[model samples]
Target: MSPSLTLENIWVAGERAPRLGPLSLTLPAGQRILLAGPNGAGKSTLLAVLSGDLEGSGGTLTWPPSSAWAQRRAVLTQRNTLDHPFTAEEVVCLAGVSGATARAVLEELGAGAWAQTPYTRLSGGLARLVHLARVLAHLDQLDPTAAWGFFDEPLAHLDWRYAGAALRALSRRAAAGYGVVVAAHELNLAVPWAEHVVLLCAGRLEAEGAVGAVLTPDRLAEHWGISGHVDRRDEGAVLILEGFTEAG
Candidate 1:
């Protein structure tokens, strides 16, 4: 059976105020959830909590109890902090998966030649792809029914081509029954593949639901301080922001 992640009334307390939460959500394995909001909307904070990097006060977080989460859960942070001298392939294998698995994931993600590159010598975009490969390989090593992956600003440094490739890889992972949660600044890019959307404004959840329900122009204006429309394009529907609104 697929595992599920459940959060009840979760909130992160800052020194003087709440950094995030009072948010409740349940994500089952095999689902795709997108976290969307402007800067400082607590999208990163929520991802930290979900990834077990930060503890939230006043709420419950639960997942499968039998396995070590380090093996079942994977995370790709926005920044690539590895300045070590290891090769990119070594970095990926550090996720506890076999070296072969790591190599395959890197190749699949269009970073095939990156395997032998020194991690510290790679450009930001290439480094990000290497880390992306690590997380995917990590999750791929687990039972798909119990896998969970979280990505924060995954497309930050990626070029358009690699970003699109990353989306395809993520889609394949979710299709294979692994739960995936991604934080995206570009909501339009995520909307095409996201099964559900969670909107956070000023550390609060402004809206949460399936893509069509949560990604409306009205909600964008209210939560993101923008007047926009979901424009239907030849490829798919895209969120187009016409202008800024003072009424957020």
Candidate 2:
């Protein structure tokens, strides 16, 4: 299904070209999506295509089209920069689509205290929070009729507080009618909140859709080359990795 924003038949090559799928993706307005994949599986590449930074080999990526890139979409790549001297407030201001939105986002991120601090002085997690605020502020500023946003490893370097804050921010973005897509290596942090989950392996889109149906241990183990067990625990399920070394 072509999303209000979507990708069809996308092919790409980076340091290495992965054979991701003859993949079909869709992004309806106001959906919360989580993308999980092993290293080099083209997760970042897919995000680049979504944010218009990179082009795909085949298929179509379509959006409802809005005022501009800033108004329509925001991307927080895994390689986000923390090299600037800007204070936290300044950093937040950069991401806002509007002034009021920027202020509001800083409030949400509790970033006002660090507003005057240089970017270089902040911790890695704090830097990521600043970037997240930017995305949020911009989205809030525009409130585009049809908007989209992507977060690539927004949880990097985050402790529990920032992790919760960062994810809550992403959820707020999605709640406000933006198509929100987030990428992470840990399924545990993402599975409960994601409306849709996309799992990719070896450059191929292994599975994508409702978390309940798409994240079975059989499929996960097959794609990840590990052993694991998944069972109903409470409202969600529990994943126990067996002899498998890493947790997906």
Candidate 3:
């Protein structure tokens, strides 16, 4: 079995309440996990902790050796600011990724045409794709075994087509034994491709399990304060949100 990243009693302090955790979970390689929750639900905080950008106040996070983890993991934040005049392809190659591999990743995500365009000249969505391609290209240079990628709101500015392409690329990485943890709000689009879901609410873990069990109507209403149902089809499960709850 591929190695698992384990967290035990993880906690992060905030000004008033905990920012996240006092939570625990095991993320195994080869699994795609969707981090689902409303705003201020700690999804971004959790990703930061897992990526080693933020330290937890308490508890242990265990993974492969530091050297291996540093080399094998990649992170894409919700917002990436690049003011320089670097071209899209240049931004991707900044990670020392080969020109061929960087262009290939951009092409895969429908951003090939903009490879030579200056980063500042691209739209928000296109720039987001370039950063994503950079992350994917960086991973491409690493060993896939036990590799992991954490993405925060990756679909933020993407159109349906590009969002689908990005999700597929992440899925491909998972299939190749890389663990993918995505912080997302687009349940309908994201849940279908993910193997597991971790639902958070107000900095606490509400539920964590397979998509079918954790994303039921009751749970949706409870955690997200919304009315929704999971429509399971041959393609995969789709989350249909009707409206907000009375408390929502």
In the range 1-248, model 2's lDDT, one tens digit per residue, is 11366677777654555445567876676777888887878788788877878767667766535457766777787877568797777777776345455666766766667766788998877888888787767666655456677889888777767677677878877776777889987666677667778887777787777776787777766666667665556766555666663645
Which regions of candidate 1 fall more than 4 Å away from where they truly are?
64-66, 232-236, 244-248
Error of 1 at 242 (Å): 3.0
List pairs with backbone clashes in candidate 1: none
How many angstroms is residue 28 displaced in model 3 relative to the true structure, after the best TM-score fit? 1.8
Say which candidate scores most in TM-score.
3
Q: Residues 1-248, candidate 1: write the lDDT tens digits.
A: 25778989999998777999888887766777788888999999998888878888879888634667686778998776678988999999998877788888888888988899899999988899999988888877777877788999877788888888899899888888888889988776788768778888889988887776787888888777898877655675677779999998
Instruction: Indicate whether candidate 1 or candidate 3 has the larger lDDT.
Output: 3
TM-score of each model, in listed order = 0.91, 0.85, 0.95
With candidate 3 superimposed using the best TM-score fit, by how many Å does residue 172's alpha carbon deviate from the native?
0.5
Candidate 2 residues lying further than 4 Å off, grouped into runs, are: 1-3, 13-20, 64-67, 96-103, 110-112, 224-248
lDDT rank, highest first?
3, 1, 2
Pairs clashing within candidate 2: 19-203, 20-203, 20-204, 89-115, 96-138, 97-138
> Which candidate has the highest lDDT of all?
3
Clashing pairs in 3: 10-22
